[model samples]
Target: MNQASSTTTSGSAAGMHPREFVAFIAALMAVNALGVDLMLPALADMGAQLGVATANHRQWIITAYMLGFGSGQLVYGPLADRFGRKPILLATLAGFVAASVFAAGSQTFAALLGARVLQGLMSASTRVLAVAIVRDRFHGRQMARTLSVAQMIFFLVPIMAPTLGQLLLNTLGPWRFIFYALAAFAAFVLAWSSLRLVETLAIERRGSLSIAALGSAYRLTLTNRFSAGYAIAAAMTFGGIIAFVSSAQQIFVEEFGMGDRFTYLFAACAFAMGVASFANSRLVERLGTRLISQAAVLALIALSVGHIAVILLGVESLVSYMLFQALSMTCIGLCGSNFGAMAMEPVGHIAGTASSIQGFITSVGAVIVGSLIGQSYNGTTLPLAIGYLGIGIAVLGVVLVVEEGRLFHARQAP
Candidate 1:
């Protein structure tokens, strides 16, 4: 019930209760995932209506948004520092709603892609500001716990969003209405944020835009050998996930002939990620981040190799594909957080800038890798399988260079 807007309280963030603050932050994080996952089931319908014929070309719907999202990450943190969080956040949320509406009304594929990019550019604020807001409220273990809880909520979106989009497509009988649903969700968030949020950055603490300083921080982030290696490795690890998502619709619906059941199977594949994340959380403290993540990478390489062998031997089936997909996804889930944490470990002082830059790297870099793999789809899962193997090897190569030919060492993460 407290309405006071002070950022000094230890128990509550500003004036809102702790639960509300966490939920609000989690909701912000969820919007980014929802933006991506909610459109998966509708991509086919959108492509047909927009006259996009090639199955791979339809992935541009997802790729365009990701490109914008990746590009936007570099600016939002610095902008938030200079302009204060609330104003910039409110503006971006409004932009998100408007862009969503624009997308909903698009008559051509190009126009829809442009709108989706704009929507993604606006939605980028949700990820930047959500973490920034959490940092403003808590530190150390509390901060970690808050992020963990928010991420738990964020992970749920991928599991359920495809099914939600399928239902919308079924009832609304058009894919554009999915954009309308997205717009409505953004509007609700905008209202909730406008009504309840307060400025977290203090006037004295507000930073001026300094290109030299920003560049220096970026330089420092990239120059740290171990951190840089982990950052790139993490991005490569994420690339596999992006590739899977980009091609999931085509593989499930068209190639596998799953039809309406695509969402259910897709959801099952996504579920493996959540389970792996849970297992990682319980095991990381004892096993160490490097060891577990390295193991996962090895598993990815092994799974991919085995998958390709099966395909070559003419033993591939929908069940085999799903099994391999789920196992690979589980590896990615295990790698995602551990690799990121390790990458950030050496850059604690410049965590914000490092996060922004690393986020850009992961997203844009993954998009590049995913686009290549997705475009290589040839009525078989071989390309995706190869993509996963490549990712695993690339990660291992980077880790070797950074660790001096080491794997699963007990030494502390840099």
Candidate 2:
């Protein structure tokens, strides 16, 4: 399909106005974040009630969901490519609603985890479809800017979800209500998307669902240097994010004694990310995605070093932790959309499968990386800091190789 109208146009070239399109896609993407965050405050309680013996094992709740989310992307991408984006998205959202209800009613920890995995498996479509649809409608700097804006909006969920979840737990009885809330919100998104989201994948652009066609699309995506490299780099960065999330309750509530303040602290960090995303949206087209994201990666490495120094100096206080965490998240915000846009830039012809493969790699790889850091949590921030530092160095190396030792060179429009 022809590129959506120029980035200068009022509405997206994808048929929806910019405001509506970003909001819709953001809401869709937020579904995944909401499913994750809304359970944070309740992890301890859920573990206690479900007879989970070890604190570290409670993280399995998050890990299981992530695994399902990652693997499900591999399936949705090819199906969406064959069937179309809208239908697949709607079906997945419907499944997400059912899964939420199933989770809410679980009588055992194993059953609850099973339901969460199913919920994540279904919600994976939102990530795949949102990226694929944007690829269908935009490219290059336009794509980067659009994703930044959507990320800005999507971060709202992370900022509010923990608080919302905590509120429900305090006022609405037990942790089960959190799952019900997830169901309610997802149902609304399902209804809204069903009504407003136009199909960006033109019928002529739809790919075959045959195994050979699927393999070829995935192969092309993996073989493309920019696509594969940026995806891996992004995955490294995401590992830091998931590590923070998987161990957040322990770090804030158990280690720092934040109590009810944990959600607010989390919200502060998320708000910082949201602010950075908005800044990236405005600046990416002007400064270039490579220049901005590369700078952010370097900044993350520096911050990680400082963070580790503070931890080792025995000066690790809540205030210091909050400042460091928020700043680190700011760097992540700057990097994420740009990295994704760069990866998708070279593979628009197979946007669905490409999005799927990349999403799977980033999600699964991040879970592995995050799991290592999370499981190593020992009532300290040292592990998390080291994770960020390692990820930053790895990402920088990959970017250097991908760009052939070049850095910050902007791409002209095709």
Candidate 3:
């Protein structure tokens, strides 16, 4: 889902060029993000509809997916590396669509949770394949540019997701319809992919797949402080954002009374993220990955402290809070792309395993903690603000550990 080769495979959409192919690949990867984003607005509604009273339980829908998504990648990436990207992708898409349909028909909380887990498992294939494909075809600035373009397109999900969710909620009924819509979307993408997607992994380039092979990649990635540190930093930073994401709808709609309008603010932040992502795409090549990512992390830490201070000072206004959050998200946009590339840069041969390891640690492992922090949302911004504060310090610590350098005076940043 990341890259389509003009030379290796059957070129683009018959007559389309390489750029178009990359865009299509990005779209495929971005759909997984959409699946996560589109569900935010509907979380509380779904929870209550499913007889889930405790706020914490509602997060299982998301956490379970991430867990499955993280763990599933371990197998998918290695298998794709050994086999071909196209076949693996189609199988995952088919599974994802089936899971989504089952999810739509879920009559119990457990049933829905299971479906979401399956959904995550299936979608993990797309994510790793996308990154690997990108790695296969492009490197450095070209990869960054492709990711930015894809992210720019992907940003539309946050912009449109809530409205779409709201429409389905009101027009069709409860949350099941949302899953139905997702199933339909998956079907559409799977169909399109079946005809258009290509295998980017060259046959000669295919590596042997064994537990030992994965172990070797894992050991190298984990021992290399530079890659390990940045990867962990990326995970912690993303953990902070996921903290908000896993809870924002419940806090705004259920606690603050925003209702379906919750999506608008979410979209607003997402749009800012898009702006910053596009800006990063342009500047990353010029400034280099380390500097951009470091700067963004600095901005995030600064804002996190500022946000907590403002809230604790008794000046609790929703407008001011949202403003700061949107600003932080802009920083998030600036940071996330580069962090991923930086973390995965060193592990070239086992890109799939590297990707899986990266995904598991940051998204899978960290999101669990993030979701718990979100579940601690207690009718105020305090918990959310405090969560950011903790995550900020944690991410900085990871940066320090990864670099094995001083905090304010680390000579070698990356």
Give the candidate number with the greatest TM-score: 2
Over 377-413, each residue of candidate 2 has an lDDT whose tens digit, in order, gives: 9999899989889988999999999998888787532
What TM-score goes with each of the models?
A: 0.90, 0.96, 0.91
Candidate 3 lDDT by residue in tens digits, 80-158? 7789677888899999889988998888899888888889889988878877777776666566676777777777777
**Can you list the residue pairs that collide in candidate 2?**
4-13, 5-13
Overall local distance difference test of candidate 2? 0.90
Q: Give the runs in model 3 whose Cα sits over 4 Å from its true position.
A: 1-16, 406-414
lDDT of 1 by residue, 283-365 (tens): 76677777888899899999999999999899999999999999999998888767766766666545456667777777788
Give me the runs in candidate 1 sitting further than 4 Å from their true place: 1-22, 134-148, 195-205, 410-414
Q: What is the lDDT of residue 188 in candidate 1?
A: 87
Please give the TM-score that candidate 3 achieves against the real structure.
0.91
Give the alpha-carbon lDDT of every model. 0.80, 0.90, 0.75
Steric collisions counted per model: 0, 2, 2
Q: How close is candidate 1 to the true structure, as a TM-score?
A: 0.90
Highest lDDT scorer? 2
How far is each candidate from the true structure, as Cα RMSD in Å? 3.9, 2.0, 3.4
List the pairs of residues colliding in candidate 3.
1-130, 2-130
In model 1, the clashing pairs are none
